[model samples]
Target: MSHAPTHVTCSAVSFDWPDGTPVFDGFHWAVGPGRTGLIGLNGCGKSTLLKLVAGELSPGEGQISVAGTLGYLPQNVTLDTGARVDEVLGIRTTRAALHAIEAGEATEANFAAVGDDWDVEERALATLDQLGLARIGLDRTVGELSGGECVLLRLAALLLARPDVLLLDEPTNNLDLRARHRLYAAVESWNGVMVLVSHDRELLERVDQIADLRDGEVRWYGGNFTDYEAMLAAEQEAAERMVRVAEGDVERQKRELAEAHLKLARRKRYGQKMFENKREPKIVMGARKRAAQESAGKHRIMHTEKLAEARERLDQAVEAVRDDAEIRIELPATQVHPGRRVLTLTDLHLAHGARVEGEWEVRGPERIALVGGNGSGKTTLLRTIAGLLPPASGEAVTHVPTRFLPQRLDVLDDGRTVAENVARFAPHASNNVIRARLAHFLFRGARADRAAGTLSGGERFRAALAALLLAEPAPQLLMLDEPTNNLDLASARQLTGALESYEGALLVASHDVPFLESIGITRWLLLDGTLRPTTAQEVRESRWDG
Candidate 1:
């Protein structure tokens, strides 16, 4: 059936963080019924914008309007540990009223509370099942659920609300492969106005359009992320051509200005000779000199203005080109020989009772992809290898120096500056050397001195990465637990690029298929009770517990 047009509009909206950091200034955008992927660099205020639309935060200026009821799923989904699934799904009150009426206690309040939602419990169960949470049931408490399950539960809650305008921010951050697939299905089936901010490439590919938030403004692209990328590539090529042409124009202007000066000097010389030789009357000579001087003055001003204008055009052309920086560093010390055994696990039993069961070995600079559902002991295994967690039964031995980058990126001392953090890790490195290296990671000059706690998500990640890579003795074995969890697309790419230079044995636990593939994962190990060897194709086709 046809329905009223659903849309969301923001007019002249302006917002800033409490610390006076500007986010949006006089920004305006509108989205009609269909899913629009809001893609941008990290710290571009994607989450903040969603919060503003959801009414969790107010704009400093302007207004926001949504055509119908709105539902929002934030990046970090937190639930009370004691709360039940039904309560989180917002059906607890209605469910209780329905049960009261079913029990023959037909009170007016119960009926009113259950108005038009008599089947809420059933609907909630169905939604949960759709999100692969059927086993969770309605009675389970949040404390019993895994991180991935919690993310899915929050999404299920939003779906149950069925609001006309839906806003989701990084909904797939901690989700497993199966949960991500479920979210993708939900997005595909959504018919209302939906806006999501996510770096998950697979999820972004499902959108109807892409709205790129950059420089405090929104730029619209007519199709999905693939289309957006193609279009951006073409635009960048054109921008580069413009820059070249502008550079040529500026050079030509410089030569012309020089020629103008040469002509002015010759004119003065000629005029002086004429006046000295008395070739004309005194008044005529004087008038001639004055005319020549004025002409030179005008000529100088004209050329100067033209040069300034040309330079401005060059600046504009350069600005049109995207300048996203890439991370580049050398780690020659991390190299491992083909026969070297980097890590070994022998009947390792973790704290939560998940066991490695048998002996496993990682040799050379092998890149291993650790894949499984959340709470599958991937983090525990990595931690054990790093010596942060002791194995309950067996042992996790590292033949080389190892470093573990946790999901939260807590490696950095928050109170310390980024430079100080890096120095802490690389105590022997000189300050100049650390700063020079930090520049390659996009923390140039004064930025390296900023406190780690004050850094944005992307910045903090870079800092933590820098510290890890710059550590003393060099990390010959690096373990990253869901490294791409909270990173934006650019930052994720940066991490991938940095890994390209890494010559160490790598073990990364992640649900990002594309990222694993990009980094050339040499082995795929499914971490259930045992570490089962699997292929990328099998991993893609397989489903795991919620």
Candidate 2:
């Protein structure tokens, strides 16, 4: 289908952090009137590019041009809790003007304030309703809303403004399934030029194209996330094939060079023998020797050049192959017998009015996914189960050792190196053993020595996971709260892989359905007002509400 004309353009854009860390150098891209998913590794500058386009950050050396007005929903939505919804939605003045006019105050100022938006309140409410915020009225304060609701409120403001260019950064990060569906619908219905930076696979599936930002450049893929994966897989396959071909060429060139050396040596030896035997006149023999030497030198140089060219080709081919390393570590001590009781919750009443009416028990290596709407106390439940928080009533008992990886990822000490953090967890293990085990988590040598605070989002996640899994006593019951919250696609996959090697019981509170399924969650628990058993299909279909 014919698409809208390009509305956003970046020309030779270059950006650098204040500390001299360079992000983009001469980056250029043009986005048309269609949903574009900007994705990459955590530190590949996807969010930075969005900030540049939205005028939140200035480029060091280039121009960012947009054809029309822009609206941006940043990844972190921080609103004044005291502010009313209408004020946040940019309609408080208009609403006041309408109310004043209705009260017979027909002033020019009120008329001007109302301007062309006579239906401003209706539109604002409609936008909020579309974003699953119908329960939240325009008169409500931001403080009354949950974190996910605040994100939707910000989105509602953007939608109400109806800017020509829209940018959303990790829009679904705090949203639940129902709210995410509403956001997905809104994205599907969006017609203006849009760019989204998110790790939410479902949200990305609604985009028209994928903009993969990597290694200081943007590569466009034509389609949604699944299509991008297909194309990327094909490209990687071809790249691998080219690498093999280039490697073979290099080997062949080496062999040819070796043969040339042997031939030249043999010829030189034969020439020397002839010279020694005086087979020909001294002058003729000298001329022959010189010619032979020159020929051999030319032959050697020709082979050397070919070898260098082959090596260059191999290097280029290798560059084309992506290096998305997976986390692979063994935790034999984390294993539990099938009949082992890992955890039990009896008549639990958690903070925020969430409870388990009856006895609940986790046995063996059961992978349970705790899911619910935002503000439904999933995190609270996990914290209580992890012994970090006490339940308001009843008890949560862990029969085995437990480790909790919170959403904040505060398990590691920022001042310490990755190896040091692991050592803190595995205190009984030797320094060499700690470093050796950390290598399986993709933190090798110097990486293991780097401070946790200096690591990127993905690297920090791997380090935290390594520390959690490598503890001294070995946690037989592992609890994670929104583990994939800010992780990139690759990092999420690495987490899944790492969990596959985990032999303990898993309790994960997350909104990431794809990730939960990939980790082989054996059971699904909906933590609404109470914890109840559910299925993956029921969760995905939103049929759990009764």
Candidate 3:
């Protein structure tokens, strides 16, 4: 597929963190005027690359060039709560100037400030409306908006800038289904050079191409995430086949080398016998012995060189094969009987004015998905159920042993190792058991000894998940709040595999429809003003009414 002309270029760029953690070294990439989905395993420098291109970060070596204006929406957006929407949109001064001129104060400075943006307010409102933020007036304070709304509001500001290049990192992270759709539409309509770093599958489906960042280099794939996956799968298949062929070559070389050694031993023994028999003059025997030794040494050297070359080829072939280790855990102890009652709620009134009236019960090993728009109290409800938060006017009780994995993944102690953290949760399990269990979570041997604070995003998630699942008494009811929020595709898939092995009750609060579906959610509850039973289709189809 053809792409737009090149708009951004990075030539032999190199960067390293202050702590000496090497990120990218001599990385080169050229992005054109079309949507490019930047993807990789967590901590592979996808976000760092975007930051470099956006000029938030400077490369240590080489150069980067952008053809036009640039705008960047970071993964974590921090806005001054006290600031007005217009101020955050960067039009506060312009709007003030326009208002002054409209009030009959047509000063030279006012005209200069207003410049050509005579309809600044209209344009700002239009941009906000386009991002499903029409309800958020320009005069409103940032504190008044929900997390997801604030994300969209930031995007709106970028849209209003009319930048030539746009960078968005995890743009759909906290967004609800409706907000995601709005963001998707905005992304789909973008005509500039757009680079989006996200784990959201649906958002990635709209991109023109995929830029896969791995091992400090970028590989371009024409088309979206699905296309990238297809291409990667094919590549991996070929690499695996080459590995097998290389392995066979190495074995054959080893056999040939062994056979050469055997032949040399036999020749040496025959020469020794001839010398012992004294069948020729001493000089002749000595000369024949030297010749045989010389020939045997040459033969051994040739076979050894061939074996070394074959081994090197095998190593290269193995390196080409990706080793994305998966979590393979068994949670038979977490299983609840088919007829057991796991949790119950009565007149559940959350802290944020959201409620679940009357009686609510979760029985057996039911997997329920709690989904809603931002500020709909999904987290609040989950916290209340986990006993971390007190309900405003009701009670939520879990009959079975339970554990909650919050979105922040704060379950782990930063100072503790993975094994120690898991031990904290599973006090009854021995160190060996804990270490063995952690292996299933992909934290093996030395990896389990790494401090929680030192882990990458995906590693931290896996560690936290292992701690929660391996807790003492084997939590029969697991509550998770936006568990997949910042997870990479591979990490997300690992979580799915781990969850599939869990035979307990699951109440997951998430906006990730694909993840919820993957975990085999048996029930869907939409948390608006009240908790109401819903379906996945409705959740996907529903738009944010706020």
The per-prediction CA RMSD against the true structure, in angstroms, equals 2.5, 3.0, 3.1
lDDT of 1 by residue, 386-466 (tens): 898888899988899998999889999988999999999999999999999899888999889888876767788889989
Q: Judged by TM-score, which candidate is best? A: 1
Candidate 3 global CA lDDT score: 0.89
The lDDT values for all models are 0.90, 0.90, 0.89
Native-vs-model 2 lDDT?
A: 0.90
Every model's TM-score: 0.93, 0.92, 0.92
The total number of steric clashes, by the backbone 3 Å criterion, in model 2 comes to 0
Tens-digit lDDT track for model 2 on 1-546? 123354899999999876466889999999989999999987688778888998899999999998888899987789999999999999999999999999999999999999988999888888988987888898999998888899999999999888889999889887888888889999999989999988898889999999999999889999999999999999999999999999999999999999999999999899999999998999999999899989998999999999999999999999999998888888799999998999989999997789999899999999999998898999889889887888999999999999999877899999999999999898889999998999999888877887887666667778898999999799999998888877889989989999989999999998889899999999999988988889999888876532
Q: Which stretches of candidate 1 lie over 4 Å from their true place?
A: 1-6, 413-416, 427-432, 543-546
How does model 3 score by TM-score?
Answer: 0.92
